[model samples]
Target: MNDHVEKMKLNTKKFASIGIMGLLGLVVIFGSVYTVEEGHIGIVKRFNEAKSQVNPGLHFKVPFVDSVESIEVRTRKNEEKMSSSTKEQMPVTVHVSVNWTVDKSSALDLFRQYGGLTQFEQRILDPRFRSATKDVIPRFEAEQLIQDRATSIQLIENNLIEEMKSFPVVVDNIQIENIILPPKYIQSIETKQTEKNLAAAEEHKLERQRLEALREVNTADAKAQGIVKVAEAEANAIRLKGEAEAAAIAAKAKALKDNPLIVTLTEAQNWNGQLPQTVLGESGMPILDLRNKQN
Candidate 1:
């Protein structure tokens, strides 16, 4: 019975050792494996110190001595609403948006220097963005900022890119979404624009009236010229008719002086053979005078 009890206890110890070894082996296998999701990079650290970096895939490390951290390598956005002043000391609120991404090649260095993504943004990006914005905002006036918003945004972006040159970040783009100015200033601008439009319209009306008056004067001058031309034509016609009538009368008088017998011959040819019924003289006779006279 004693021998059987000792054998049973030995088997129990072996079973317990096997179970514990199996449990430890399972823990080691599970702990050695890690997966880095797509668009992320993994950093392996040993004893709180960064040792190596890995890409997105299944990777293995020392079971209990090493750990991995995954950082996002995708594009990210940070938007900030900041109050700043223009060149003329006008207070304005600007909404700025920055599109950025991590430089994958420098991911390890980034982690080493800044610890993590959050720390990098807080320590480097946010402060630099604010500084760049403040520096650029004061260079433009309120009216300039409103009228030339694209130039202002470009200046800000350039400042920011220069500021982040030494950091491990890629600034894809920067946008100035909105600029809020004073209410009174906006109202004054609108009123000025309205007045300018009214002035332009009035000027257009005056120009139209001037053109209309000029056209009427031209028409009156044309009509006057036409009347003068018609009067001159009528006078010319009357002169020509009088000259023609005078020419015909002179021709008839010349013919009569040139030949006196023409009239007697024409009269004898027209006379019929007849005698007078009564005479005024004592002797009953008819007298004829056929002579041409000139004055």
Candidate 2:
């Protein structure tokens, strides 16, 4: 009897322990709070009224008194409409993208008003974006809009930056990927561009040819100038040399005229005093008779 009673007591204790554990599990699952992770914002709500937000890390709230809502604070994306701009009946499509991230500083305040970051997109973001796009895009013709994609995107970004400052959304970038024009317009643009390109190429080729011709003419002129300079130097040198030679000859003639030996020899040759192929010497010089020619 004692052993049976002891076994019953042990089983009861075990069942009680399991029931307590089950109750604790249910309380933890239903009543406790959890943290929203990094890159996430937690929105707190009480009786469907938004209270505040928490950024990352662990946080706690009253058990079963408040509920937590989580939302991504990172950038989001969507495919936007690219409606035609002007009444010119020109239909063009522009593929654009937007990059936006939640503002960490304003997360708590944003969550109180918006409930979650995604709510910002539905209530605040979409409305502002549509209004801004309608105002800005229709201001230009389709042709003008296609050409200035960057400018248009900039205007949209500025508008977003101004309006989204109140919310947690921060605009990082806005881009236009492509401009899709009507087939007829596309064909016209392509043809015009081709003609312009051809004209540019021909102009470039002609300029190159002209430059080459000019270079050749310049080279020929330089060579001709070099040859003329060399020829002039040679002519000057020859003229100076000729003048020097003439001066030398005049000096030699003057020296010979001043000598007595040349004059005496001329007189002796002209003498009617006879000259012979062979003559006898009188003193130390040869003497000839003048009357020998009459014999």
Candidate 3:
């Protein structure tokens, strides 16, 4: 009985030693090393205080004394929707998107100042972005907000970037997703544009009528001028013909005055078998007595 009791006591001691060794092995295995993933940074903490930063890969730490906290340095995206008023007192809703990442060089300071990436974004970047949208949207009119949307977006982005200059967050891009205006305002704009188009059309019609009237007047004047030219030509032709006839009569009278015998010859050539009772000369005296018949 004494020997069996001693054997049981020795076996209990051996099992206790094995259990202690296993616990120590687990502690050494788990606490000695850490891994940093791709695109991540490991901040090593010794005794609850930050000591150093490690890049992606396998790294060793003091067993049971050191701890590592990882922060993603990869780019991240966040979106916000803002409501604002334009310069014209028009209400608008704007949707905005932001792409950002932790500045690698400023990561330690960032983690030290703020607890983590979430705290920095919540406390700094998001508020500034919202503030920038509110401030910039009011500077432009509603029409400008829609027509020059790209410009407005750029302005907002620039304001956001400037606001974040003192922070460690790197703002990669800011984009305007949508801008919605009131339906009544859109209808009013369309009505005004329609009125303007109608007025322009009326003005164009008047211009066309005026041009047509001018063309008619020009055509009438041209026809009148043609008629006047034809009448003048006819009058000139009549005057020339009268002048030619008068010249011929004058020439014949001069020839008759130069030779009276030509008239006697003309009379003899025209006489028939019957003779006239009297024949008068150029002096109004009887030249031939035909009262007595010639047997």
- Which candidate wins on TM-score? 2
Model 2 per-residue lDDT tens digits across residues 1-295:
9999999999999999999999988887757757778888887777767777777888877777788877777777744666655436676666667778777767777777775656767888777876666566766777678777677888878887787776656788877777677898878878988999999999999999999999999999999999999999999999999999999989878877789687678788888985465566768575554454764
Model 1, runs deviating above 4 Å: 1-13, 197-295
Across 1-295, the per-residue lDDT of candidate 1 in tens digits comes to 9999999999999999999999999999999999999999999999989988899999999988999998899999988899999999999999999999999999999999989999999989999988888888989988889889889789889999998998888999888889999999889889988999999999999999999999999999999999999999999999999999999999978988999988898888987976554446556556533344578
TM-score of each: 0.67, 0.73, 0.63
Local distance difference test, each candidate? 0.91, 0.76, 0.87
- Models sorted by lDDT, best on top: 1, 3, 2
Give per-residue CA lDDT, model 3, range 46-110, as digits (tens): 88788778889999999979988888899998899889999989988989888988877777778
Clashing pairs in 3: none
List runs of model 2 lying over 4 Å from the truth.
Answer: 1-21, 24-26, 86-89, 134-148, 253-295
lDDT, model 1, position 81: 95
User: Which of 2 and 3 is ahead in TM-score?
Assistant: 2
How many collisions per candidate? 0, 1, 0
